[model samples]
Target: MKILVTGANGFLGRNLVEQLRNQGYDELLLCDRNTSESELEQFSQEAEFVYHLAGVNRPKKETEFIKGNTEFTEKLLHLLNENPNNPAVMFASSVQAELSNPYGESKKKAESFVQAYGEKNQTPVAIYRFPNLFGKWCKPNYNSVIATFCHNIARDIPVQVNNTETELTVAYIDDVVKELISLLEKSSFNETSVLYEITPTYKVKLGELVNLINTFKESRNDLSVPQLNQNLTKKMYSTYLSYLPEDDFSYDLTMHVDDRGSFTEFIRTPDRGQLSVNISKPGIVKGNHWHHTKNEKFLVVSGQGVIRFRKIGSDNIIEYFVSERKLEVVDIPVGYTHNIENLGESNMVTLMWVNEPFDSQHPDTYYTEV
Candidate 1:
């Protein structure tokens, strides 16, 4: 089906477009200030539905919010009214619109326009009020609390949080997109206008949300530096933890700390690939075995370690000292024996990206005397 999506480049809009495309809707017209009027007109002519998502979401001044949100909706409605077909339109409102704040007020005004248009005209309109949205493709700015926490943790920085145990609901981007697609595909709402609230059913505590983010960071073998600033105002603290950029890395293996001093590994499997392990704690050592069909690759995420390797035909030993701020990608040929030991006080973590899936059978692993 032909569809038009505004604010196409924005975080949620981008995800919605992807989901639509994946569902076999490719005849999409994307409209934003970035597109020309001619482009919009062309899109309007071709689309059977329009997902109205464009607006001035964050205004430095209060008046701009009215213009960006309310006025923009009016302009789009006028265009739709002028068209012969008057295709169905879905308006993306926000939970804030029903509550307080200039941003919410503006959205409510836009929503009113959409509701009135749907009642007066032949076209159908669906309004979806969204809550906090998170996941990949999240932008760095514009008040994203989840992104902020993820960014701080990735950088090993402490995530500041308010002491309040207030409940916050979040909607994963993928799920939101899926719901939008389902609404578009179903004809049940055609007989009348519809308004729906979208959010994950479960509510998470503010502190628990921060901890979940920290867990994900640590699981990925990433560094976390947490700082608690008790002196800042609550509002300032909230704003500070809402727009952090994510860290992207390529690695072959990830080491995570478990209940005790023991470590768990997230190893990426690749045939004939090399894996590197960086030891953060002195005297800690890793695997002392060789794989038959499992080739591996490794790089140190942080700290220092020593790699020892041996071959069946050779009696000689080879060792390499890996240090922080250094990246070493190693390739272990099949049946090659190796082990790693840490040489520092801090715990070592490694980033790993692999091409194969894990398998327990025909393990392709054999141990040798150290």
Candidate 2:
């Protein structure tokens, strides 16, 4: 299908175009702010569908809002009406259009024009009043508060929040794009209401949002990962990572090295648990320790090893033979002293997951013989 997308370089336009191409759309008529009117007219004539995304939200002059939003939309509709083919139209309107501000007035006028054109020409149209949108490739320091916060916080710059208690309804860019695709496929709507609403939006407090973003920035040195079970935090963290500087994608972790081998912590979370890697040289043993409340699962990924565990007050010892030949997990129970001895000729690598992160202040660990 030939689809024309105005403001193709804008935040929503870029994401929509990229995803459309991924879904096997080849004939896309992309128009940005620099595209000439003559070119837009030609593209509109050839397009089977139109995504009218071009609009001015932040402009140098107030009057430019009407010119960019209302006047431009009027011209695009006029060109589409001249074409013999009546293509389906979709407009990226905003929830602010119901307000009395200049920007809102412009969007309101543009939305009215599109609806009128759709009724007169009998062309199908979809107008979306989006909330605060956030995702990758969004321009920082403009329009989107989430984008600005992510960019600034990642760079170690302080962010200023005037009303930290202010709440906002936000939508992820992927969700917006998915809804657009659905609109194209179904093209179903009620004649009474021309508005199209997207589902699964998230509501966040401004202060909480900033705090979550700050945690993402601090994860570099802390070797911690955010709690992804919360839907909003997961998406927010992903969006934050997308704005990181090119050279700062990776960070190194400190490995505790000794003659026996090395142990490195990879990730830690408050409630989810922690992951660490342990290396033991041949004939070397590590971890003659027992904990009061912590439990661990150890998986031998390389070489052969024997994990021996003994109850704190008992002489009975349980031995589990582990090797790279067969993957198996050994659990270290609470109040039990445990140790792993490398039995192979080469070094052994083990992946360990503990239910709780290690703390130096109150290290529940107590040294004992296994």
Number of the top TM-score candidate = 2
* Per-model RMSD to reference: 12.2, 2.2
Q: lDDT of candidate 1? A: 0.69
- Give per-residue CA lDDT, model 2, range 1-370, as digits (tens): 8999999999999999999999999999999988997899899899888999989999999999999999999999999998788888999999999899999999999999999989988878889999999999999999999999999999988899999999999999998998887766643655677898878799998999999999998998898888888888899999999999999998899999999999999999889889999999999999899998999999999999999999989999999999999999999999999999999999999999999898899889999988
Model 1 lDDT at residue 194: 65
Best by lDDT: 2
Model 2 spans with C-alpha error above 4 angstroms? 187-191, 310-319
In angstroms, give how far residue 214 of model 2 lies from its true place: 1.0
Question: What digit string (tens of lDDT, one per residue) describes model 1 on residues 1-370?
Answer: 7888999998888888888887788888888778887777777777778898887767788999888799978877877776666778888898888788999999999999998877777667889888777766676445677667766776777767777486777666766777777767647355654687664434667887776655455534432222323211222223334433324554444445542234434432234222333334666777688867666666777777777888856777778777667888766566568877777777766544333444577667788743
With a 3 Å backbone cut-off (N, CA, C), the pairs that clash in candidate 2 are none
What 10-residue stretch in candidate 2 is worst by lDDT?
A: 183-192
